[model samples]
Target: MNYTQNEKIKQVDEKTLVVGVDIAKETHYARTFDNRGIEYGKVIKFNSTREGFESFEKQIKEIAEIIGREKIIIGIELTGHYWYTLANYVNKKEMMLVQVNPYHVKRAKELECTK
Candidate 1:
């Protein structure tokens, strides 16, 4: 099965900043949200590497400035033993890491659909 990078982020618009990422062996999908939870941009593909870190740094800086906050919260579905690298990167900065259950995300989607 094949999946597009943008398919990972659901219900994006221009509100409270949120990013949905699908962790993969090679690359990941990223979607962004604004202060009001509205997505106002494109979903781009990001790889896990040195250059990837550079790009992520630039984006994170922009996000921090937008919200006037030094810290950001990043959530990823816990993939047991494989996402340590990504977790480390977030932990090294003035940011927080959240573990989300895929089940919960699905439930939320269901609720949103009913709304």
Candidate 2:
């Protein structure tokens, strides 16, 4: 299902923990944050393998529990085909996975640097 920006924003509430992932060919990095954009924990680095995915899931769960969040929304950049396996893993776990545009991300970063 497609959601407008407002609708997507509405899905993230106080009970949600947002995780943004930077995808790569071998290793992936993740950062955790809350609805208000307050970051939590250190950057999580994991390999692009089943064991790595399992470790990533474990870390996410632990962070959510610590932060008292019941819902998780993981956003990953649609970097070529590097995200496919991770996306499937997230889907099997019944968690929400959002694909972000790389171009938009680059522009956003540029804008942030200006500010």
Q: CA lDDT of each candidate?
A: 0.63, 0.95
Per-residue lDDT of model 2, residues 55-102, tens digit only: 999999999999999999999999689999999999999999997888
The candidate that achieves the highest TM-score relative to the unseen native structure: 2
Query: How many pairs in model 1 have backbone atoms within 3 A of each other, for residues 3 or more apart or on separate chains, i.e. clashes?
Result: 13
Per-residue alpha-carbon lDDT of candidate 1 for residues 1-115, written as tens digits (9 for 90 to 100):
3436464343233333566666777686666655465653566577777677567767856865775544455667776565677778777765556677989988978999994
The positional error of residue 40 in candidate 1, measured at the CA in angstroms, is: 3.2
On a 0 to 1 TM-score scale, where does candidate 2 land against the true structure? Answer: 0.93
Model 1 worst lDDT window (10 residues): 7-16
Q: Which candidate gets the maximum lDDT versus the true structure?
A: 2
Give the least accurate 10-residue stretch of model 2, judged by summed lDDT: 99-108
Each model's total of backbone clashes: 13, 0
